[model samples]
Target chain A: MSAVLTKDIVKTFADVNAVDGISLAVPDGEFMVLLGPSGCGKTTFLRIICGLERQTTGDILIGGTVVNDIPPRARGVAMMFQSYGLYPHYKIRDNIAFPLRTQRVARAEIENKVEWASNLLGIGHLLDRRPRQLSGGERQRVALARALVREPTVLLLDEPLSNLDAKLRASARNEIKQFQQRVGTTTIYVTHDQVEAMGMGDRIAVIDHGRVRQVGTPTAIYDDPADRFVATFVGTPPMNLVAWNGGHLGFRPENFLPRELIDDSAVTEFSFRVDRSEYLGSERIVYGVLEGLESVQEITAKLPPAHVDQESIRPGEWHAFAVRNSALCYFDKDGKRAIRH
Target chain B: MPRPLAAAIREVSFYSAVLFFVVIAAFPFYWMVITAFKTNSDLYTLTNIPFWFNEAPTLAHIKYLFTQTLFARWLLNSLIIGVCVVAITLVTALPAGYSLARMTGRSGETLGIGIFMTYLVPPTLLFLPLSRVISMLGLQDSMWSLVLVYPTFTIPFCTWLLMGFFKAVPREIEEAAVVDGCSILGAFIKMVLPVSVPAILTVVIFTFTLTLQEFVYALTFISSSAQKTITLGVATDLVRGDIYFWGELMAGALIAAIPVAIAYNLFLDRFIAGITGGAVK
Candidate 1:
């Protein structure tokens, strides 16, 4: 069953259409991520689902019930914020128990749940400490614990890991996924980081300009993007987009191979001048300007260290390269993916 | 070495300037305390004696002020009015300020600004017409008149003060509460209020002090000996027929300033936190 659903949700702020009539469904126990650039209404859509924000005109159903006019508290949902939003004055135990206490659960039950949550998050020893005393990662765990302790039907996380440093973000992301899986709760995660969406989500909804560009499993979205935006947005160093004749050809840098590896009679082959190369430990990223293109089209190719001699390939030297047929993505004039004929 | 000496001289000059300003600000209060304990003869002599307590200090003025005049009654009246005004101001201001802070859209912002602007309208201009309104309610020459009138200034000022404070609280914290099954009111009470204790305490102190020291309204509205507040009673009785009781008047002034001074000294951190927190953000 669809645990949470929105149909044609529209939200406008003054002259700006912040959420412009978007629709989607989050199935039971699914980790759905709304991935987009900042201000693309991903967070707005999450807020609408959590009932923190009111949609201008839409139907929001949680667990198959229309909840448009329902207040957030009655919606049976909990949100973990990007800032953690742990009550600075409350100890970790009270913070986790807040929702249960508000619901008038028995005191023993509240204590048991708080303990369970703290243990789950590896914060059992820190329950007596206030949020101010905890480090950023600890506070984040406490926030997650607070939300999970409620055991709501759905959990909404709004860029919850964005505040952490780079190294912490990576480990924290895995921990968040692990926690969500163990809880088996329907989760809607919002982030602009495509890597996070790819790593954390069961299904990724790529959004831009207040609209959903595509929604599919992370693998499908990455391998067969619905549009040029999703294609470039999902990859490391982004997909290399080069205008070819009347259409645009997209391919990942890792897919490009040296000419010696490809058959001479290959169907797609291009000659380019090597402009620059960056050595990223295990692989060399060679940036080249395509020879026969009208625009200054630069294509980057990731070459394994074994295949090419770094000393031989100097800048301003022309080279021939070929892309694997399965790796090439073609986009028509409107920037939409053209179905392969 | 020579450069260090010049720097030392500059530092000494800076400290001297600060000391001069501190003495200027504090000298009047110091003199008030000393004069309060002085005999009538010592006050009349007006000597520039710095440290020595030459003559035996008398508590006659303090005794006379307390017993011979309606000073105690006026003090009680002021205390009653101040406390009531503070309580009323806080009750009205907190919720209203929270609403202004959390509610989105242009209307909420406009309304918040509108309420604050009402505070800026000069009280001196409004009090004359407000006096007529007070008399119509038959609160003239009564402590109740001062109680009712003081809130007109206190509520708006405090609401504005607290609106800034409430705005400083992160919206995410409130949202987290809401999602945790808290109604808007619950979120306010459980989350916003606790974090905002310092700001609220500062507001209480400010309102209490303002209402306690208010002169124009208290002087204008109340006329009876029993009904007059501290400021009115002291000014009227001590300066009878242009023969000022400087010694006794200073004594009364010193006594009256004690409560607020004590309150401030106790909660200095909260006051600084509220003003700086509210102002900067």
Candidate 2:
């Protein structure tokens, strides 16, 4: 059975649907990431799943049991907040032990579980110190340990790495992913950063404006986005859309390389004008408009640095660029993906 | 002027301003201390230097305050009222403030403002109706009347103060606790209240000191000398028409002020920022 499942959850705040009907199932031991931009209801959806927030309509099930009327503590879920939310006054030991103590677990077993959790997170030495005394990364580990101490049925994390520095975020991401895998706990992670979602998620649920736009494996979500929003929202220098046959033709920047780089027999060609070029060490991004669609739309082509020397593409000049026939993504006027006509 | 000399002049003027304010603020305490210790003869003599004692200092006034009057009973009454009122204020205000702080939209702000507005109605105006209520409760001339009436002011202001504080306490902490096997009230008591020690201390000291020094309501509600609070007793019982017992009055004021001073010093270090640090960004 799926460890956690929501059936058409809708949470309305002040007549505004903060979490509009979102139904998702997180299978046992799967890392499901809810990915979106800020204020996109991803966190709200996670909160609903955790029982921190009640859906205005619909039922929540944990381990196949309906938990609509159950409180957060009884729902067998644990959450790590965006801020890490370690109890500021408690020592790390007590913070990790708090959940078990609340459940009135046996004293010796609480100690053993606390030790197991601290050991799992490798925070055994910092047990006596308080939360404020720890660094940001340490605090994140402590929060993770506290969430994992009880061995919950589902683990919900809401942007838990956002408070760390850029350098720390990468390693913290690795730590949490590896830690989650080691424990094999069903996890639902929320984040706006595509890098984290793509790198760590077993499956990514792309959400926007209180609705899930797409739910697929990261590779599928990136390579075969279900809609224009997912296609445009997931990649850096996002997918370029130009007016095509009264609809939109979408192609990733990396796929729209110079014609010289295309080895495929089937290709669609465009006369690309390079207005600006940025050489970002590993790749070159060329920004320009296509010949016929110049005034209406701008397109981008990301070329691998090895394939194109920086001196080759000059600004304010025209060059031939093509996307393989297989790489083109057609979308209807409503931003839904459509098969090529 | 040369740069060094200009800097020197600025430095001198800054210290001079600081010294000026310090002396102005401390002058009353200095006067109280000296008068409390001065002998009756030195105080009554016109030629004696007012700032310092001409005769040997004595504890005679403090002795008189304790033995010759209901000063000890007044102290006990003030302590009881302060404790009771602080308890009531915390019990009422903490939950009220936490809920108000967490309440969504403009309603929390509106309700908080409504509660604080009651605090702005001065006790001078409030005492008339309050006195009627005190009499109706049959608590007139009892220190319990002051205890009952004090939270009417304290809870409102403290609730407003604590609402601002609890609002600053990140909602995520309490939410985390709730998810980690706690009820909403448990989260508040475990997660919210621990980090809010500084704010709670501020409320305790504010309520206690306000109760200790309050006179108007104490006077209106409790007419008996034995039931008078420290402030009311010090002022009224130490005065006989135009003849004021200045020594006993100063002694009483000095003694009543000590606990608040100690409380401030005791909790001032806790009014720090790092309590919630490392928990959030």
Best by lDDT: 2
Alpha-carbon RMSD, each predicted model: 2.0, 2.6
Model 2 spans with C-alpha error above 4 angstroms: A294-297, B270-281
Residue A255 lDDT in candidate 2: 94
**Interface C-alpha RMSD per candidate, 1 decimal:** 0.8, 0.8
Residue-level lDDT tens digits of model 1 in B183-268: 88888898999999989999999998888778888878988889988888888878989788977898999999998899999999
Candidate 1 chain B minimal-lDDT segment of 10 residues: B45-54
**What stretches of model 1 exceed 4 Å from their correct place?**
A263-267, A294-297, B46-52, B104-114
- What are the clashing pairs of model 2? none
In the range B1-281, model 2's lDDT, one tens digit per residue, is 89999999999999999999999999999999999999999999999889998999999999999999999999998999899999999999999998898965579989999999999999999889888898899998899988888999999988988888888888888887888888888998988888888888888888998998888887787778998889999899999899999999999999998888888788776533323322234
Indicate which candidate wins on TM-score. Answer: 1
Candidate 2 displacement at residue B214 in angstroms: 1.2
